[model samples]
Target: MKILAIASAGGHWVQLLRLKPAFEGHELIFVSTKTSFKETVKGHKFYSIPDASRWNKLKLIYSLICVFKIVFRSKPNIIITTGAAPGLMGIIAGKVIGAKTIWIDSIANVENLSMSGQIATSIADKSYTQWPDLSNSKVTFNGNVLS
Candidate 1:
């Protein structure tokens, strides 16, 4: 099975990398906002897109296009993201292309699910929260990524 794993570039990337062992047997394709991350996923495929945020409309649109194109071409069996904006785009594009999407909210958002994580609850096939309190009908209380 092909799994497309995506994240922005900081804690999101770190958390995503922690899940690498889970992807051992599968074909893994990683996407991030930094091409510099290629070295980290060295034997697998990697792609980079412009980092964008809600505060930046033009960059966000461009990023959405780039992410959608990658998702469309990869045709992955599953898409997973520890997100901000790029992962959200991947989930949306993944769904459109019939791939199962998983949203793993950043662990930093203790008070609530991050904005993108909240939206992902309705879109992704599965959504997870590190905080049990944040888990509900839409999101599951998965064990901590750091643990």
Candidate 2:
């Protein structure tokens, strides 16, 4: 399967990378906020889009456009992300193109799902929370990446 794995830089990106083993045997095209991350993903296809947050509407649209183009061109079978803002953009883009989407909420969100995670439950095909307590009918609690 061709998977588009996207996340923002820092913790989101690190957590996304930890899921690499699960994507073994599939083609992984990674998207992040930093060009430097291209080196970290090594042999996989990598893309760096503008980093944006909910506070910046303009940049968020620009990043979404970039991600949309990537998803449109690649036509990945699945899309996944450990998110902040950019990863949400990816899910929106994938939704437009009919690619299955998955959102794994960051391990740091203990009390509740992040704003993006909450939104993803409606957008993504599968949504996961690292904390079992957060799991409900919409989001499932699977094993975490940090463990």
Candidate 3:
């Protein structure tokens, strides 16, 4: 399977990396906002997009464009993210291209899903919450990346 794994820098990137083992035997392509993350995902295909936040309207638009281009060229069968804005952009682009998407809410959101996670619940083919208590009709609690 061709998998496009995307996440922003910092905690989201760390959490996304932890799921690498789960994607074993697949053709994994990674996308992050920082070029510095290339070292962490050595030996895999990696792409860097501009970092943006919900608060940054202009940059977010540019990031979305980058996501469209990457997703189009990669032609992944699946797209997965433990996210922030950049991850959400990947999910949106994946949806537009008819690729399946999985959104794993960060373990740090112990109390509730992040804003991006909540949005992903409606768009992602599968949406997961690390906390069992947060599971609902739209989101499932399978296993966590941290575990």
Best by lDDT: 1
TM-score of each: 0.98, 0.98, 0.97
RMSD of each: 0.6, 0.7, 0.9
Candidate 3 — worst ten consecutive residues by lDDT sum? Answer: 138-147
Q: For residues 1-147, write the lDDT of model 3, one tens digit per residue.
A: 999999999889999999999899999999999998999989999999999988889989999999999999999999999998888899999999999999999999999999999999999999999999999999999978886
Each model's lDDT: 0.96, 0.93, 0.94
Count of clashing residue pairs in every prediction = 0, 0, 0
Write candidate 2's Cα lDDT for 1-147 as tens digits: 999999998899999999899999999999999999999889999998999987889998899889999999999999999998888888999999899999999999999999999998899999999999999999999889898
Candidate that beats the other on lDDT, 1 or 3, i.e. the better one = 1
Local accuracy of candidate 1 as per-residue lDDT tens digits, 1-147: 999999999999999999999999999999999999999999999999999999999999999999999998989999999998999999999999999999999999999999999898899999999999988998999789987
Candidate 3: where is the Cα deviation over 4 Å? Answer: none
Q: Candidate 1, which segments miss by more than 4 Å at Cα?
A: none
